[model samples]
Target: MTDPLALRHEHAFDIRINFDKRWSTGPVYGGASIGYTSIGEGSTVEGPMLTGTLVDYSGADWPVVRADGVVELNAHYMIRAEDGALIYIRNLGYVHRPLRTKGQGPDEEPDVPAYFRCTPYFKAPEDGPHAWLNRTVIVGVGQRQPKVTAEDPPDHSLFRYYAIR
Candidate 1:
């Protein structure tokens, strides 16, 4: 069996942020190629974002920081071949949680919800120009730690971001 966390190169779409909803979606043009290594099935990656920082670059600044606000992410990807093609492909297979900047990780493990229609973006094929294809979103958390030994640790914070398909 293949390791779920194995690294692979793939094409991804541009990422767009939905300011009002505080969510991001893939681009509509063509997919952007990206290099990713699997972190493992059902594993959480945590990080921190500057308090009250805006996530979207193009939109007005909206504060994401709060006494409670922390970025949390959980998702899984799938590898498959496009129809009638021999090449193996990996896409965001499921979105388990909303993107938010918060203080800590979720208390329980997340579950993969239903699949949604991903935005189609153009991606340059290996041998030709870019073409449109629906891209998936990958979600993971970020973590911050204090400089301390394993026995005595400081605070831990979690952040989240989505990679384009």
Candidate 2:
């Protein structure tokens, strides 16, 4: 028998935000984010992701609502090396944050909170050149930096992603 762990390797990925649009309904804050990924090492797979976040602010003080968060992420990837083969990914996770304000103001700063971690499930064509992702389990770690400005439709949270071995 062979060691299964010995055959697996960890790869890191860099995520850059394209945009995030956030809104609030009563005490619930929710938003959608779109971004791209830069794969690590020699992988030619790169793509965009759309994520949705919901923050509950009913238990905090006025103005500055601090609470736990949950998010849903959906990604579509293209393999540049394999003539642009497509891959799909889905991720769901929780966010841990400190007491922070939502928007920027004269006396308030943007919420720069803690990191969020998630497990990503990949789906790829079995016959595709990069089909190995379909059978692999990947863990993702992310950092959040929420931005608020005076402009209309200010940029929201920015996140970076790293894949765990």
Question: Among these predicted structures, which one has the highest TM-score?
Answer: 2
Alpha-carbon runs more than 4 Å astray in model 1: 4-58, 68-133, 138-165
Worst 10 residues of 2 by lDDT: 54-63
lDDT of 2 by residue, 84-125 (tens): 445555555555554355555646653665656666566667
Alpha carbon lDDT at 3, candidate 1:
75
Overall lDDT per candidate, in order of appearance: 0.28, 0.42
Using Cα atoms with residue i matched to residue i, what is each candidate's TM-score against the true structure? 0.18, 0.46
List where candidate 2 sits over 4 angstroms from the true fold.
Answer: 1-9, 27-82, 99-113, 147-165
TM-score, prediction 1 = 0.18
lDDT per residue, candidate 1, 67-142, as tens digits?
Answer: 2222122222222122221222222222223433345357634333322222211222344221222243334333
